[model samples]
Target: MADELIFYTNPMSRGRIARWMLEETGVPYKTEIMTFGGTMKSPEYLAVNPMGKVPAVRHGKTVVTECAAICAYLADAFPEADLAPTPDERGSYYRWMFFTAGPLEAAATNKALGFETPPDKARMAGYGRFADVMNTLEHAVSTTPYVAGDRFTAADVYVGSHIGWGLGFGTIEKRQAFVDYLGRVTDRPAHKRAVAIDDEAMKIAQ
Candidate 1:
């Protein structure tokens, strides 16, 4: 194998992010679908990702997990796609990318679980509060077409997916800025192709 990319995922999981990134890269890769509570937790698969998560990829001897990381990795790996930032843009690109991965994810999950942060304890929360996180995100996207700056980058791939999914599932409250940002980033042919593939797979699985 001369550094082939092997994608392990389930259609319904965060693997959708990686799928979108892969499609954006226009990369050819083999996909292995694993069912929850079965092959996903099996010893063989656990060896690949101890977390038993979907959206794990093996590129040659390298194995990468986490949706945001995979998106950033693919962008850097496929520079011709222009999904990565130049050195000058790296700060903004990385800022929002990690913000979504850490604070945004935590805030959304906490809200979904109905875990409210007491006022006094808000300072201790990494996301401060879901409302604050949402406000900050809305502001970031409102300032630019993409998360990082004037152009679309890997940061948009990661952050946009979360916002889009959050809006679709009602995990994140509706905001005009979010709606507009999601529309702009997700209008690409790559995103549509990825959605079509996953939608078909989801229908089949159902």
Candidate 2:
């Protein structure tokens, strides 16, 4: 049962984040590539994730879904990877990680689709509007070397990937803080390997 980790993802999907985390963990897992509207919709894949989403992982009998959850889970599961934050650092770690997954993701997607939250109804919005989310994120990265201070933990993997992708695709507004932080995270050897593998897979996919 040593290599019982199973990773289900598509190169063209958010699975890249999990892939990067997997590479960082140095875990030997199986990759099951799924296609949109094809095998991804099948009953088999649906059983793994009723949401029928990519980037789900099965660790022995435990199944983990959502990119952020998978990354965080692996950090604890493979302690040798040293991706989890210390007890003292857990506050910031969980804060920014969930922030990125929740508010940031929603705000960015809504903005990308040309949807704007009413200014008067700001409280009704999860992110309180896109600019607020970006400003909060900028402050987070600008003040620390990583999301959770000096250490690069699973939090950075989730948050940094969002910042990187947001900047690249013009979804999130670019800030110098985001630029610097992305450079720092993307330069990691594990991140590079993950990107290379996904890039090749994407090329072959096309």
Candidate 3:
């Protein structure tokens, strides 16, 4: 018998990113929709994720948390999806993925909260200046058809989500490169399906 895959998430959270990746994998899994300040903080769900956060995955005995890690793990776990990068693609794959998860996420959140790192304190920040992070990210998506390379790998799933969310919420600048890159990566059946699922879930929650 094969191990069961379980996904814990809320429709209104980063779980949407994992939902897209799960759809891309074309695998059978179970979904648990957790509500904020409710089931999410329950002892049962807390056991799965100490932080009581949405977007955690449990594949049999193994548990994976964090959106980037979930994307990479799903790609590797279901090799048939071909979302994981090849040997040569590993460099860019890991590079952009981690960059989005760390610097990009930190910088965007801080900016949205109206907090900026001072010049002298920039050295202490992992993302440095907000402008620098934006410039580097624009160059990344514009230089290649996808973040990892010519192909759309798990890296795109992670990177694209951040860019898309940022653009949508006005957190990230509306650069031409960012808009164009988002259009390229999201024009897929899996993305469509994922959006539809989450949208319906949102309606229900409302």
Candidate 4:
């Protein structure tokens, strides 16, 4: 089958995360840039992903959508890249990956909307209220050099993207741990290449 990876993305959107992950893994992927009211929501795109979102991937006939799932999927599919955890690393891998997707993004979005979860049932909330989630994230990032121990696995692509976006948008508190972490990750040669290419494209489009 060629094992070619195809990506549907809008350079201006969250699909940028997938781009960076692709760069990190040193894997080649074809990009089909879509527009807001354009192919993203089309029936053709919807066949691959009912949600019709950016950051969907095609590997032959199998399609993968959702950024977290995409990151995990590609990591396994490209075993030579070693972007995923070993069997023993599953616990921390899934924990931090889903933490970025569920709690971190939820808290950041809630912060952006200026809505606060009620204190009474904060624990019941997946994000566990903003302060709790944010502080917990700060602690989590501080303790681990990477999300899953010393290895930089697919979890970093998920979690580091959160830290990068949160810091950029002022959604997260921009604590020192986040700042340092973002700095370390962004300094990576692959990340810089992806960011430079994407940033230049955005400037041209503007």
Residue 133 in model 1: lDDT: 94
How accurate locally is residue 206 in candidate 3, as Cα lDDT from 0 to 100? 21
Give the per-residue lDDT digits (tens) of candidate 2, residues 86-183.
88879888999999999999998987898999999999988998889988999888888988988789889899889988998899887888898998
For all candidates, the clash counts are: 0, 0, 0, 0
Worst 10 residues of 4 by lDDT: 197-206
What's the TM-score of each model vs. the native? 0.96, 0.97, 0.98, 0.93
- TM-score order, best first, reads 3, 2, 1, 4
Q: Candidate 4, overall lDDT? A: 0.82
Of 3 and 4, which scores higher on lDDT? 3
Checking candidate 3 for backbone clashes, the offending pairs are none
| Per-residue lDDT of model 4, residues 171-205, tens digit only | 99878888887776677787888888778767643
Give the top-scoring candidate (lDDT): 3
The candidate 1 region of ten consecutive residues with least summed lDDT is: 197-206
Please report how far candidate 2 places residue 104 from its true position, in Å: 0.4
Find the candidate with the highest TM-score and give its number.
3
lDDT of 3 by residue, 118-179 (tens): 99999999999999999999989988899988899989989999999999998899999999
Encode model 1's per-residue lDDT on 1-206: one tens digit a residue: 45899999889999899999999999889988888888899999999999997989999888999998899888988788999989887998999999999999998988889898898999999999888999999987998778888998888999999999899878898999999999999999999998998888886552
Which residues of candidate 4, in runs, are more than 4 Å off? Answer: 203-206
